[model samples]
Target chain A: MMNRKILLHSRPQGLPTEDTFKFEEAPIQEPEEGQVLVKSIYLSVDPYMRGRMNDSKSYVPPYPLGEVITGGVVGEVIESRSDQFSKGDKVLGMLGWQLYNVADADKLQQVDENIAPLSAYLSVIGMTGLTAYFGLMDIGRPKAGETVVVSGAAGAVGSIVGQIAKIQGAHVVGIAGSDEKTDWLTKELGFDAAINYKTTPNMKEALEKACPNGVDIYFDNVGGDISDAVMTQLNDYARIPLCGAISSYNQEEGSDVGPRILTKLIKTRSMIKGFVLGDYADRLPEGAKMLGQWLAEGKLRYEETILEGFDRVPEAFLELFQGTNIGKMLVKVESTE
Target chain B: MMNRKILLHSRPQGLPTEDTFKFEEAPIQEPEEGQVLVKSIYLSVDPYMRGRMNDSKSYVPPYPLGEVITGGVVGEVIESRSDQFSKGDKVLGMLGWQLYNVADADKLQQVDENIAPLSAYLSVIGMTGLTAYFGLMDIGRPKAGETVVVSGAAGAVGSIVGQIAKIQGAHVVGIAGSDEKTDWLTKELGFDAAINYKTTPNMKEALEKACPNGVDIYFDNVGGDISDAVMTQLNDYARIPLCGAISSYNQEEGSDVGPRILTKLIKTRSMIKGFVLGDYADRLPEGAKMLGQWLAEGKLRYEETILEGFDRVPEAFLELFQGTNIGKMLVKVESTE
Candidate 1:
C-alpha cells in the first residue's frame, strides 16, 4: 500500500502561503519490533502550530524544513509487533499530517470508540479542553459573582473556558470576531454577553458596557487590541491567564507593539501570568477527570467543525486564522474508511 | 504654638511646579481627650506621594485641593491626653507636611531611638524597607545563582531591594540614571553589575552586557523605556514584582505607553505582580524584625538625603524626579528641635 504525507517546504516570514507546504507519496513501512503501523482517521489543526512554523525560540522546537508536519492524530492500529496493542485497536497519539505512520507502540494510547467519537479525542477531552481547564481553574481562579472575560470566545479553548466560568457561577462575557459567533456564544454557550469586535467601532466602550462591574478574571486566547481593551476594565487584584496570542503570531517578531500595561497594573495591584498546556503536565489526570465529570453531568458542551479528506488538512489550518470555525477545527481523513 | 503647612493648591498637568503648593499659617490644633499632639521632626518626601497629588482614585485618597499634604512623619509626642503616650516619647505616624499634628493615641507607634537613629524609622527599618522586603521575598522569590535586575537602584526601595537580593545569593544587576549612583550600587551595595542608563546610548545592549545570564527576577521601581528593555531579557518562569513606576508618574494619564508585554510574557511563560506594602500590613512586624536583624549584622546599610529646613519640603519632593538623592529623601523640620 502507498502512504501520503505533507511536509514543510519553506518557512514564511508572515502569514503562510500555499507554497509553504509540499505533498509526497511513499510505500507504507512495516512495523518493526515494539512498533505499530497505524491508519490515520482524524487530524487536529491548532493555532499554536503557527508558532512552530517560525524559526524562533518557543515552548517546542521549530519545525525543520522538509519533514512530515506533526500534530495530534487519531488512528486505528492495523499491525502491531508489541505487547501494548493489537490489530483493530483504536488509538490516539501525537502523530503527523499523513495517511499512515509507523510509531512506537508504547507512545500510543488506546481509546475506546464506545465512550465517544474518535474526533473528540483530539478536542474537548484532549489538549485543547485541558488548556482551558488548567488556565482558568489554576491561574484565572474565577470566584463566584466575579466578572470573567474571554477573548476569541468562539474558538476551541475559549468556548470551553466560558462554559467552565459559567459552571463556577461567574458572570461570563465573551469577545469574538463575528456576529454569528457572538450569537452562538450568548445563545448556545450561555455566555451573559458577547461582543462582535469586527462590527463594534469602539471595543473599550463595548467592553466597559458589557462588564459594568469591571473584569475580575480575563482568559486571553487572542492578545493585541482586544486584550488592551480588556485590560482597561480590570478590577483590583484581577488575574489574567494568558493562553495564546493568535493576533500577533503571523506578524514580524518586533512589530507587536502597543500601549504598555505596567502603570495600570501598579495602580490596580493586579497580576498577569502567561502559560502553556505543558506547564501543567503533572496534573493532566486530575484535569481529565474533572472534564469527564463535567461532560457526564451535562455541565459542559462542545462543538466540532470538521472538513473531509486528508488533502484539505492545510486548508483547515489556514481557516483558523480566518476565524471561520465555531469551535475545534479538525480534518477527517476519508482514505482510512 | 503656630503651624506652617503646605497645601495642594493646584494639580499640575505634568511636572509639579511652585504654583502647585501653597504655604499657609494657622494655630496649632489642640489634642482631644483621646489624642496626642505630635511635633513633627523628620518628614518623608517619597515618590509614592506624587500619586496622591493627582485627582484620581488610588490606594489612598487624592490630596484634595487646598489642604495639608499628608505623608510619613517621625515626631516627638509633646502633649498627651490619653494614657498610651508620654511627654518624651519618640513616635512614628502618618501626619501632614506641617510642623505639628494632633492624632489619636492608637494611631501612633512609639519608636525607640536606641535601636537606630530617628530617621531610620522613615527609611531602612520602616515603610520603605518593608516595601522591598515583601516585594522581593514574596513576589520575586529569587533563587541562589539566579540573576536579579533592579531599576532605580540608588533610590530608597531599589537600594534595599538590591541588597536583599544579594543576601539571597542571586547575581544582582542594577540600573541607575547617573554614574555616581551606579558606582554606589556596585561598589558599596554588593551588586554584581551596574548600568548607567542615562549615559548608555543603547540601554538594551548595556543590560545584555551587564546581565550575562538572563534575568530571573525583576524588581521594577521605574517603568517606561528601561522596563521595556528589561522585559526582553527575562528567562523562563521569571517573576517581576512591580513596586513603583516613578518614570511615568508625571506624564499625562494615557501618555504612559510603550511596547506591549503580553506576547513576551507568553513566550517566556513568566508572571508580573503589582503590589503595595499595605497589602502585607499584618506581616509588618515580621519584615521589620528581619530588616533590623540584617542592619545589626551589617548585611544591610542605608543612606538619607536630608534637606535642612521644612521650607524646602517641596524642593526635596521635586528632587526625586531629578534623581538628586542617593537614598531616602527627607525634609528636616528644624523648628521642632
Candidate 2:
C-alpha cells in the first residue's frame, strides 16, 4: 500500500503560494505496539496555519522545511495494535496531511459519528468550537443585552462565537469579507446585523451604525484594519478576545502596525486578551460537552466548505486566505466506510 | 479671608507651559447648611491631570477652560454645618486648586491622621494607594515568584505598585526615567532590579537583563517607548494593568503610536486592561486596610516630593512631565497646624 502526503516545501515570505508545499508518496507501514493505521477522512485547513508557515517565534513552533505538515485530521482506524482503538473506529487526532497515518492509539480520540457529521468533529465539535467557547465565556464574558461584534464572522470559529453570544442573550453583529457571508450570518445564524467588510469602505462607521450601542465584546479573528475599526467602537469596560490576527499572519514581521490602542483602552477602560485553543486543553472536554448540548438542542448551527480528494488539500488551505470558505474549510481524503 | 486659587488659563498644545495656568484670589465664603469650609493642606498633581487639560472625550471630562482644576486634595475641615464633618478633622475629597473649599460634607471622606501622616491620606493610603492595589491585585494578579515590572516606577502609583508586588512575593523590577529614581527603587524600595529608561540606549536588552525570567505582570504608568520595551520581555500569559500612559499625555493626537502590541499579546497569550481608581471605589476600604497593615508592619514605605506653598502647584504639576519627582509629587498648600 502507498501513502500520499503534503510537506512544507519552504517558509513563506509573505502570503503562501502553491510552491510553499510539496507532494510526496511513501510506503504504508504496519502499526507498532500501541499504534494504529488510520485512513484520513477529513483534514482541517485553518488560517492559523499561515503562522506555522513563517520562520519566526510564536505561540507554536514554525513548520520545519521538507516535513509533512501536521494538523487536525479525522480518520478511520483500519487496523489497530492497541486496545484503545479498533478496526473501523472513527477517530480524531493531530495527524499529517498523508492519506494514511500510523499514529499512537493514545493520541487518537474516538469519535461517534451518530451524534454529528464527521467534519463537525474537526470544526464545531472540535478545536474551533472549544476556541469560541473559552475565548468568549472565559475572556469576553458577554453579559445580557451587551453588543458583541465578531470579526471573520462567517468562519468556523467566528460563526460559533456569534451563535454562543446570541445564546447568551447578546446583540450579535458580524463582519465578513463578502456579502454572501454577511447574508448567511444575518439570515441563517440570526446575527442582529452583518457588515460586509469588502463592500463597507467605512468599516468603523458601518460598525458604529450596526452596533447603535458601542461594542461591549469584540471577537477578533481578522485583525489589521478590521480590528482598528472595532477598537474605535468599543464601549467602556469592553472585552476583546483576540483569537487570531489572520490578516497579518501571512505578512512579514513589523510590517503590520495597528493603531495606537492604549489611548482608546484608557478612554474606555477596556481589556484586550490574545489566546489559543490549546491553552485550554484541560478544559476542552467541558467546552465540547456544552457545544454538543447546544448542537443537539438546535441552538448552535454550523457550516462547512468541503473539497474532495487529498490533492485538493493545498487548494483548500489557500482558499482560506482568499476568504472563500464560509465556515470550516475541510478536505476529504477518503470515504468513512 | 482671601482664598488663593489656580485656574486652567489655557489648554496645552504639546507640553504644558507656565502660561497655561492663571492665579486668582477669591473671598472665602461661609459654610452653607450642608457644606463645610475645608482648608486645603496637600494637593495631588497627577499625570492623569494632563489628559484633563486636553479637549477630548475620556474616562473623565476635560478640565473646563478658565475654571479651577479639581483633583484629589487632602484638607482639614476648619468649619462645618453638616454633622458628617467636624472642626479640625482631616479629610480627603475632590477639591479645586484653591486654599479653601466650601464642599458638600457628604462627599468628603474623614481620614484619621493618626493611622499614617495627613499627607499619606493623599499618597499611600488614599486614591494613589487604591489605584496600585486594585490594578495590581485585581488585574495584574501577580503570583509569588513571578516577575513584575513597573513603568514610571518612581511615580505616585508605580512606587506603591512595586512595593505591593514585593509584599505578594514577586521578583520586582522597576523602569524609571532618572538614575536617582532607579536607585531609589532598587536600594530603598527593595526592587530586584531597576532600568533607567531615559539613559538606557537599548531598553529591550536592558529589560531582558533586569528580568532574567520573562515579565509576568507589567504595571504600566509611563506607556511609550518604556512600555514597548516591557512588551518585548513579556512571558506567556502575562498580565498588564494599564494604569496610565503619561508618555503620550502631552503629545498631540496621532503622534504617539506604541509598537504593535496585539501580535505580542497573541504570541504570549497575554492580556492588557486599562482601569481607573474610581472603578474600585466600593472596594477601597479593603485595599486601605491591607495597605495600612503593610505600612504598619514596615513592609511598605512611601516617599513624597513636597513643593511648599500653594503658588508652586503649577510648578509641581510641571515637574511630573520633567520626571523630577522621586515618588508622590504634591503641593503643600498650607501647614498642618
Candidate 3:
C-alpha cells in the first residue's frame, strides 16, 4: 500500500506560508523486529512545534529538512512484530504527519478505547493535561479566593489551566483573542471572568476591572501585550508560570521587544518561572491518574477541532497562529471506520 | 537645641539634582512619653531610597514634599522617657535625614558597640548584609560548585552578595562597572572571577569567558544591558534573585524599556524572584548569628565607604548612580568620639 507524508520544504523567516511544506507519497514499510506498523488516526498540531522549526538553540532541536514533521499521533496497531502489542490495538506515540508509520513498540502507549476516545490521549489526558496540572498546581500554586489569570485561555493548555485553577478554589479570569472564545471560557469552562482582548480598547483597564483583588497567579500562554497588562496588576508575591509565548512564535526573531516588565516583578516581590512539560516527565503517571479521575468525575471539560483528511495537517497548524481553533487543533490522518 | 534636616524640596522628574533637596534648621523637640531624643551618628544612603524619592507606589512610601527624607540610621540616645531605652544608649532605627531627632524608643534596635563597629549596624550585620544573605540563600539557592554571577558587584548589596555566594560553595563571578571594583572583587573578596563591564568590548562574550560553566545563580543588583548580558549565559533551571535595579533608577521613567529577557527565562526553565529584606525580618536573628560567626572566623570580609559629614548624604546617595562606592556607602551624621 502507498503512504503519504508531509515534509518541511523550507524554514520560514516569519509566518510560514503554503510553500513551507511539501507532500510526498511512498510505499509503506513493514514493521521489523520489536516494532509495529501503525495506521495514523489522529495527529496533533501545537504552537510549540513552531520553536522546533527554527534552526537555533531551543528546548527541542530543529526539525531537519526533507524529513517527516513529527508530533503527537494516535493510531491503530494494524501490524505488530512484538509480543507486547496485538493487532487492532489502538496506541498513542510521537509519530509524524503521515498516513502510517513504523513505530518502535516500546515508544507507543496502548490506548484503551473503552475508557475514552483515542483523541483524548492526544490532548486532555496527555501532554496538554500534564502541562496544566504541573505548571498551575506546582508553579502557579494558586490559593483559595486568589485571582488567577490565564492567557490564551480558550486554547488547549490554557482552557485546562483555568479549570484546574478553579478546582483549586482560585478566582479564574481568562484572556482570549475573540469574544466567542471568551464566552466559551466563562460559560462552558467555568471561568469566573473572560476578556475579549481583541475587542478591548484598554487591556490594562479591562484586566484591572476583572481582577479587582489583583492577580495572584498568571498562566501565560500568549506573552506580549496581554502579559504586560497582567503584569501591571500583579499583587505582592505573585507567581507567573511561563508556559508558552504563542504571540511571537511566528514573528521574525527580534521583531517583538516587549516592555520592561521585570521592574514590576521586583516592585511586587513576585516570581516568574519558565517551564516545559518534559521537566516533569517523572511525575507523568501521577498526573495522568489525577487528570483521568477529574475527567471521569465530569469536573473537567474539553473540546477538539479536528480537520478531515491527511493533507489538511499543515492547514491545521497554520490555523493555530490565526487563532481559528477553539480548543485542541488536530488532523485526522485516517478514518477510524 | 537645634535640628538641621534635609527635606524633599521637589519630586525628581528623572534624576534628582541640587534642586531636589532643601536644607533647613528647626528647633529640637523634647522626648515625650515612649520616646527618646537621639543624636544621629551614621545614616545609610541606599539605592532603594531612590524609589522613595518619586511620587509613585512602592514598598516604601514616597518622601513627602517639604518633609525630611527618612531611612535606616544608627544613633546614640541623648535622652529618654521610655523604659525600653535609657540615656547614652546606642540605637539603630529608621530616623530622618536630620542631625538630631526625637524618635520612638520601641522602634529602635539597641546596638552593642563592643561586638562590632556602630556603622556595621547600618551595614554588614544590618540591612545590607541581611539583604545579601536572604536574597542569595533563599532566592538564588546556589548549589555547590555552580557558577554564581553578581551584578553591581562593587556596590553595597552586590559586594555582600558575591561574598555570600562564595561562602555557599559556588564559583562567584562579579560584574562591576570599574576595573578597580573588579580588582577588589577578585583580589580581596575571594571571587573566582570579575568582569569590568565598562571596558569589556563585548559583555556577553566576556561573561561567557568568565563563567565557562553557565550561570546557575544570578544575584541581580543592577538591571539593564548588564543583566541582559548575564541572562544569555544562564544554565537550565537557573535561579535569579532580583534585589535592586540601580541602572535604571536614575533614567527617565519611560526611556529605559529593558529587552524582553523573559523569553530567555522560558527557554532555560529558570526563575527570577524579586524580594526585599523585610520579608525575612522574623528570621533576622538566625541570619545575623551566621553572619557574625562568619565575620569572627575571618571567612567574611567587608568594606565601608564612609562619607565624613552629614551634609554629604545626598552626594553619597547620588554616588550610587555614578557607581563610585566600593562597598557599603554611608554618611557619618555625627562623630563617635
Best by lDDT: 1
Listed models, DockQ each = 0.78, 0.64, 0.64
TM-score of chain B of each: 0.98, 0.97, 0.98
Candidate 2: residue B38 Cα off by (Å): 0.6
Q: Model 2, B1-337: lDDT tens per residue?
A: 6988899999999788988999999899898999999999999999899999999878999999999999999889999999888899999999999999989998999888677898898899888888999999999998999999999898889999999999999999999888888999999999999988778899889988989999999999878778887888889999999999888888876566655778778888999999999899799889999999999999999999999989889999998989899888998986444
Deviation in angstroms for A242 in model 2? Answer: 0.7
TM-score of each: 0.98, 0.96, 0.96
Task: Enumerate residue pairs that collide in model 2.
Answer: none
Clash pairs, candidate 3, are none
What's the residue-level lDDT of B300 in candidate 3? 85
In angstroms, the error of model 1 at A4 is 1.6
The weakest ten consecutive residues by lDDT in model 1 chain B span B252-261
Q: Between candidates 1 and 2, name the one with more favorable TM-score.
A: 1
Candidate 1 residue-wise lDDT, A1-337, digit = tens: 7999999999977778998899999999999999999999999999989989998887788999999999999999999998999999999998989999999998899998887789888888888999999999999998999999999999999999999999999999999999899999999999999999999999999999999999999999998989988988988899999999999989877678877788788888899999998999899999888888898898888999999999999899999999999899999999444
Give lDDT: candidate 1, residue B296.
99
Kindly report which residue stretches of model 2 are placed more than 4 angstroms away from their true locations once superposed. Answer: A335-337, B335-337
Where is model 1 more than 4 Å wrong at Cα?
A335-337, B335-337
Best by DockQ: 1
